[model samples]
Each structure stands twice: as C-alpha cells, then as structure tokens.
Target: MTASVLRSFWIGGFEGADHVNGAGEPLDMAAATAHLELLNGDYLRAREHGLLTVRESIGWRLSEPAPHRHELARAVQVATAARRHGLQVVWTFMHYGTPPDVSLFDDGLVERFASFAAAAARALAPLHDEPPVYNLINEIGYVAWAASHTNLIHPYVGDPQGLGEHTEASGYDVKRRLVRAVLAGMDAVRAVDPRARFLHVEPLVHVVAPHERPDLADLAERIAGYQWQVWDLIAGRLEPQLGGHTGALDLVGVNHYHSGQWEAGTERRLRWHEGDPRRRPFGALLQAAWERYRRPLIVAETSHIGVGRARWLDEVASEVANARAAGIPVEGLCLYPLVDRHDWGDPAHWHHSGLWDVDHDTPLPRHRRLVPDYAAVLTQWQARLPGAPPLPIAPPVPEPLPESRANGVVPCTT
Candidate 1:
C-alpha cells in the first residue's frame, strides 16, 4: 500500500529580525514586506509543485515591543498572504529570540511572553478558526547551548573564566523559565482559541563521543534533559528537583540539521557532519521522539550547509516514510529557507542552501536548472514511485542559465 503525502510550507523568520543577525535588531517594515513577497512567491512556486502547509513564525520580540503595545501588522500581512495562496500555516510563537529587554531567567519575562502569545492568538484567530499550531520556542536545547556552552548568541561569550561561573546553573534556569513562559503563553491563547495546539521544537543531539570526565557526561545528560524534560513536564511526570511544571508540550517538532552531531571532551569537539545514507541519525531522532513523547512529530528544519540539500531532503523524506510505516504519526516536513537567504548578519555572502540558487546580480533560468544534490533527490524519489502524481508545477520563475549542461546529479559517496 502507498503512503499518503502531507504537504506543508514554513514562512517568516523565527524572530522577526534576530534570525537575520546574531545581534537583535527590529526588522525593517518595508524590507520585511519585500522578503514576504519573495516568500509568497516561493509558496506560489511550491504550490504549483504540490505543497499545502506552510509554517511561519510570530516572533515575541516583534509582537510586543513594549509590555502592552503590540505590533503585528507585518506578521498579519504574511499570514494573510499565505492563506490566500491556499496554504495552512503553523505559527511558531517563539524561535530563539525574546524581547531584547526581557531576560529568560526573569519571572516577569514569562508572564509578559504569555500575554504576548495570547494577544497574537487573539489577533490571528479571526483569520482562521482552527487556531494556528504555536511552537513555543524553536530548539530550546540549542538556545541553551548558545547561551551556556558555545556562546554563539546572547548572555554568554564562551568566556573560559566564565565557564565555571554559573554556566550549568544559569543554563538550566533559563530553560525552565522559558518552558514556563511557553506554558503561560499557551494558557493565554487557550482563552481565545481553545482548539489551539502547542508545538515544542528542539534539536536532537547525537553524542558521538563522551568526555573522559564523569562530570562532562553528567552535563551532557543534563543538556539532553532539556529535550525530554519539557515532555515530562507537560505529561505531569517531571521530578520536583528539576522544578518542573505541567503542560509544556502538545506536539513535538524536531529541527535536525546535518550539523547536529556532538563530541564531548574538555576541548569541546562538536562538529556537524553529514551522515552516511545507511546510518542517518534523523531516523533515530524521530524514533526516539516517538518512544519518548508519543505525540505528532514534524521535521521543523532539516537541510545541509553549502550545496548538499537535495541528498539531504531525499534521505530525510525516505526516513519519514520508514517511520510512518512503523506507526509513527509523522505529520509533515518543511523545507526551510524556502529560498536562499543572505547570511544571518552578513547580507553580502549567500548561504547557497536553497533548492534554487539566487544571484543578486542577474536573472536565472527556471527549468532544466537544478542544484546537483537536489536533482539527485528528485530523480530518486521519481524512480522510487514512477506513477506518483507530479507535484503541481508553478509557472517557470526566471533563473540564470547553467554554465554547464549536466543533467545528472551525483549521489553522495561519503
């Protein structure tokens, strides 16, 4: 028997402007509108190709710039455009960036966030009745890692001296506080849209190596705790020592990038490596999530850095199919960055990870043009199901003609 495919789309940045830069800045309204136009065009393109659901974000930082004042005109425009294109949106309320003035550790922050989430739901409820699925935060585990260990983001700078300075304590505290804030936010939304559902997104960690020190192992366990802890909290199974609360997750969203593998030691040998097709970790992550949470799961973000996206998507789609055959309720998968985006903070350099490559300088061709890796997935999936319905085709968008006429894509041998 053939499995049914669930189509979906992801729109907007996690936090309005923060997603574009490590430094939190308010997104320019005009520029943001133009970006939305690009996103809408991508949706129209994808729709022509056969996708139905698009997940977009409602950033806390952008929604409520101040305690009571709400700013949602931009988000509304995006959401409305998405609905017009006949797409279902899964609204992610928080994706890593909170209001600049709010500290994750503050109780006030939690209350304020809850209020903001409630406000957002109220504003958006009229557009659709099936209250949007609210992802409380994106990758809480990664957020904690950024603030506590890697110092890639705010509040921490990876200071060696500060390493011993409340790193673990502060990290855990911030995580717990954020979860509470999410719960509060959900409660507020329920007041407006009782049918609303919650989505908890986190990175799945594959510990490749454990450090020699038992303490390091314990720390790793604690970090892993962040993933399961919210589930436990919501299911009313959290230990008192963890300062747990009830009702933190309703759905599970896993963001599995190729770079999620980790190695532990004092030197911190964490590196993101593409896995062999025969041993993909994304499957393990989904299986683990099913065993642990038993909730609906979605691949929130799964792509590779540079130009290997096609193979990455094929492997991920196959894994999803396998998991579904095994009775896992794998609801949907979203291809992130719908189009290639400029580097987070540095707009000059392109990430080159989109299905279609973008050159700011010139026009590009639409058909007979495929990224090698993406083309591989397209061929494999087609071969796997020769009679499958073709994805709805969007009118050909312009693309630069390929310098070479190669039509075949190389499968990854590594």
Candidate 2:
C-alpha cells in the first residue's frame, strides 16, 4: 500500500507514553506536557503547520485499571477532539506500561491486553471516516530490553547490576511475550472492527564492534540482530506458534534516533556526523527493512533535542527523500512528541525535542512556544517531498495557555 492511505506524508506524534519509570513512578507524558489540557490547541497547531496525520494514545493502565474492567470514555473524548480538528490518527494501544495488577512476565498478559484492545477498538471505530489505524504496541523490542537488560522499566527497576548474560537471555524471553501480546491484540481488534489497520513500530538501529576490539565483530552483529527480532516474530518468520502471520506485519514503522547506532560492548554511539565510516546512512537501513519484510514502511518516530533538532531532521528528510526516489515506497516521516516532553524518570529536565517547547517555569497548563528554525527545516522538506501538504506561508504563533484550563487527563491508576 502507498502513503495515499494517509492524509499527509507528515505526521505529528503526541507524547503519550504512560510507562512506569526507573524510580517506580508512573509517567503520563501527555499530561506532564499539558497536551491533554490543551488538546484542541495542540491538534490545531499541527494541522495549521500542514501536518494532517498524527500518532496518539489511550493509556492502557488508565483505560483498564482492573481485569476486564475498562474505562474508555476519556479515550473516546480524545478521539473526538482529533476528528474535530480534521486530523487522521494512528492510536497507540500501549506504550510500555501495563495495569497495576498486570506484570510483563505473567503468562496471562497476552489475554488481558487483548481484551483491552478489543474494548479500545469498539470505542474508537465510529470516529473515523476510514478504518482507524492502530499501532498495537509501541517499540516492543525496546520495552523488553528495558525491562530485562536495564532498570528503566519495571521487573528490573533499581537492578542495574544485572545487565549480563542472564539478563540478556531474559530480554529475549520478554520479547517473545511482547510479540504474543501484539499478535493477540491485533486479533482482538480485528474481531471488534475487522476494518481496523495496524502498524508495527520498532527501533531501527545499527551496531559495530569498537575499532580497537576487532574480535568483537560477531558480538556486535548479534546485538544489532535484536532490532529485527520483533518484525521477524510478528511475520511468523521466527516463531509461528505465537499466532503471527504475514498479516500481523502490516505497516512497518521504523523509529530512528541519534543514539540508534553504537559500539556493542561499550555502548558508545557511532557519530552521525564527523565522517565515521562505520556509520550507515538512514536510507540504507530503510532499504534493508523493506527488502527483508517486503512491506510498505514509514519513519514512525524521529527527533533530536535542544540544538540538534533541525539538523537531525535535515539528515532524516534527505535520507527519506533518497529512499523514496529510489522506489523504496517509504510512506511518511513522523516528528514524534510534536510538543516537547520531560525525561520520564527525571521530570524536572525537559528534552526540548519537539517543534514546540514547553515552559517548565509556568504553573499547571504550561505555555508552549514554537521553534522557528525547526519549523523552517520542516517546511523546506515539505516543499521538496512529493505529495506533501502545502507549506504554510508563515509559521504559527501559539498563544499562551490560559490559567483557567485544568488538566483533563485521567490520573494514573498505578
């Protein structure tokens, strides 16, 4: 399928992760960034800037606080807002967070999440003119790695010392569970609304041995291989018993970030600039994914923080342009966290990673200001890309959020 299915080649992603952090604190990024309180303005800003397609989420923890008990009225409200703003949405059912009673390791998580997925589809199916697109689970591979190999996610919080061979094995086991969850969730949604579409999003990465440690080349290849495991599993190429099939691998989304490539053992990121021969072009990675999956692809998520935002986009846009020109059929590029967000574990620190920056000093309902340079770069790419939305003659100037506006997002149940 082509990008013609989407409203535009540019997509804005709202920061909707509700994952529990390393500190054991549950995070609601959409609420923290004031996106929930300022939904209309946020969606309007994206549409005004020529982005008609967006990625959104309905928190699983909040939507289903207890087993088989779902509260999706608020989620439906959010979907209504998107429809009102004339934007097409790709809703993320889960973003690395599960209910308080549910553990990632539980054999029952797949069924629990599948039930929630069906409930969500039932609530949202009527809002869209076309079949609503759903990203069943965001970054399954990364979530598994974080939970097992690192302490950033649950089941491993405050357990950084366990990052050795045992943890590495655990990571794969967790990945298998996540893949099963995705497959079951896809089936559940289809049962509720057969026309519902799905997007499987995962990190796109490259890895290499440290220059001094040439003997570690094989190890580096194994580490890089983790990136493909999620896709392979969903395609039934790796494990068919999970109920995966070619249909489970729908619109493939590859999220690229500056830290995506690195030296294996030391974890030192390969420089995206300064002539690192080991660094691969983003277009090459996209091509490799297409050739392997033979599925239509999109850059599901990509952005940089502070000073690098525009430059990163320039590189990504160039790579995407080349990929499309070469007949890759890469559909769209989404600038994630359309508005800036704070670090999950350290809410005091803002990433300054979005087209709009949030003011931390302000009280509840913080103000968001546009980054002119980033907008200019985005506009330039919009003009260059075929079938892109028309460039706005002038950048949008966001007004300060009113103090009377209260945070409408459901409180975290965890």
Candidate 3:
C-alpha cells in the first residue's frame, strides 16, 4: 500500500536588504546565488528536485517608501524569474518590515496598508491569473515575542514583568492592520484577476506545564484568541475588537518552529530543543487545527540550524504525511531560507537557525549533508504518489479513566 504525497519546497531570502547577521555583516549575494544555483540550479534545479512551490515576499519598505508610489523593477525581476522557472509563487506582502513613512500603531496604518496592498496586487496580477496568495504577516506571535520580550527589533523596549502587555497590544494592532491590508490587497488583485487568495500566518505556541503558572493558562487562552481572532473577525464569526476593516482569510498559514513549548516555573530557563517531549508535535497541532477549521493548511516555515536539520526535515515530512493520511488538507511544507541567512536583528549569534551553516564564510546549500534526509522524505511520499495504493492508517488511542479514589488507587476492574 502507498501513502499520500505532499510537495515540499521553500521561500528564499529577504528582498531590499542583503542577508546579514545581527552584527550587520552583509552576505555576498553573487557568491550566495552561485551557491544556491548549484543546489537547485536556476530553474531546472528546483523543478527537477520536485519542489512544486516557492515563497517570496515584497518589501513594503523598499517598494513604497512614500504613500501611493511603488518601486517595482526589482520585484518584477524576481517574480518574473520565478514564473519563467515554472515555480508557483506564494508572495507575502509584509514579512516583517513596515514602510518608514507609516507607523503601525497609528490610527490610519490599516488604511495605508490597504492602499499599499492594492497597489502591489495591481502590479503583480498581470503576471499570473491565479489570484495571488497573500501572507498578511509572517509569524505574528514571534514578532510580538521579539519586539516585546526579546528586544530583538523595533519598539525595542518592553515590559516583561507586566505579562507582555505592551507586546500583546502592539502585536494585536499590527496583525489586525495586516489582515485588513491583505483583504484590501486581495480585492485589488481580484479587480485585475478575481481569484486572489489570502493567507494569515501565526506561530504555534504550546504550554508545557499548565499546572505551574495559573497566569500562563490564562495567557494560553489569550494567545489562542490572538492567533485565531483576526481570522474570526474577518470571517464575521466575531466582532473586530482591534481597529481594522474586517474580512475572513481564504487560508490560514502556520509558521511553526521547533522551540514553541512554554514550560511553567521555567520561564527564564526556556530553551529551544529538538526532541522535547513536552512540546506539542507538529502532527498533533495540525490535526487539531484541521478538525477545528477544515481549511487548507500550509507549513509556512521550518528549518534547523545545526547538523541535525536533516533529521528535523525527516520528522516534519513524516508528520505532514501522517496529517494527510488522517484526511487533513495539508498543502505544502517550506524549508525556510533555502540557504542559511543571518538572523534579522540578533547580532550576538544567538539564533543560527537555517538549513545551511553560514559560518562557512561562504553560503552554500547543506544538501550534501541534508540530501539523504530529503531523499528519505521524497522516497517515503513518492511511493504514495497519485495512482498508488493507499497506506494503512494507525489505530486510535483509548480514552483515559474518569476518576480516582482516595486510597491512591482507582476502581479499575476491567
């Protein structure tokens, strides 16, 4: 019997700015591109490797420094190149950067973003008829984590002792505005090509020990609210508490990472690890999500920093397969940063998470080391390709007992 196959690929590089570390050392694009070309080889490389999709983001800051004006030559060059190569593009409107002229907190940021989205959609619609899929913001929770807790980027100062109120408020506002921008962008693209799809990406957060911190339990509920609230507002299931125009998203994008678990009584000691049992597995997360929303799900980003990334990819691909076998509408999985790049604002070398190792002094694909794992994924799923026999499903687990007695023993006579 064969299993279902899910296509895997990646979104590569940030636009406008060259890949750089937290210390601001710029990577050599010429050298990096040459290296990437070898791994995926221009057009033939990616296509032959079986990647059905590619992800890219247009920089709002770079494209439109001022209101209503767009600098699209570079964007057009990239998008055109991707199309010529036969790769489907999922273009993100705002990955992290905002236009220098607009303040995200401002009352009018939503309107400004909508207008910008419209302009972007208008410019890109001619190249493709598939209504453009727009990722309103990448990892909304992580953005808040960086800005509010880690001080990794703008609005650097945050009140950590205050349960991240400032960060939460800021993140909520930015996300609300971003969704509005996406809807506006979709409308704009639809005017040119009416099939535009909107995608919203949020980080997956897991509470490791709910019993330890009562506050964290409350926080967990709030975080889930934050994650899905924007979509609900857009879909008209809930009222818009944040100040932004409302409309439901066409797809929900998930930017899951290895380090998503939150352990109570260990807040300060929380560290990113690969095989933590307390962490919610990606398969479980996706399954619960599919059952809840029943919409198409895409793994927007996943990559490992050290030599273990290959193993990480295997685990993730298997999870995707499992999800698909269980009847979940799993669309794609993206190994973010096709080649390793510098951490956005962290210059201390704190986060070296990428598929390729950047410490090589020259960028190159880690494929030689990673190919085996990639091949394992390919082989596992390829066997399940169309027309192949369906794979057998695993048996379900039994439910737990209802209650216990006072003698530290339950009345279990089964």
> How many residue pairs in model 3 have overlapping backbones?
7
Could you tell which candidate, 1 or 2, scores higher by lDDT? 2
Clashing pairs in 2: none
How does model 2 fare in lDDT? 0.81
**What RMSD does each model have against the real structure?**
13.1, 9.8, 12.3
Arrange candidates, best lDDT first.
2, 1, 3
Q: Give me the displacement of residue 288 in model 3, in angstroms.
A: 2.2
Query: TM-scores of all models?
Result: 0.76, 0.90, 0.74
lDDT of 2 by residue, 193-293 (tens): 87777789998888898889998798888888888899998887986655567767877899998888888778788877555789889999999998998
Reference-based TM-score, model 3: 0.74
Query: What's the count of clashing pairs in each model shown?
Result: 17, 0, 7
Tell me the tens digit of each residue's lDDT in model 1 across 127-236: 77444677767666556556665445555454446543222432555666666566556667777787676767776655433445655766655545556665565444
User: Which candidate ranks first by lDDT, i.e. highest?
Assistant: 2
Winner by TM-score between candidate 3 and candidate 2 = 2
Native-to-model Cα distance after best TM-score fit, residue 237 in candidate 3, in Å = 2.9
Ten-residue stretch with the least lDDT total in model 3:
405-414
Candidate 1 residue runs with Cα over 4 Å from true position:
1-34, 129-131, 155-170, 210-226, 239-248, 266-280, 362-414
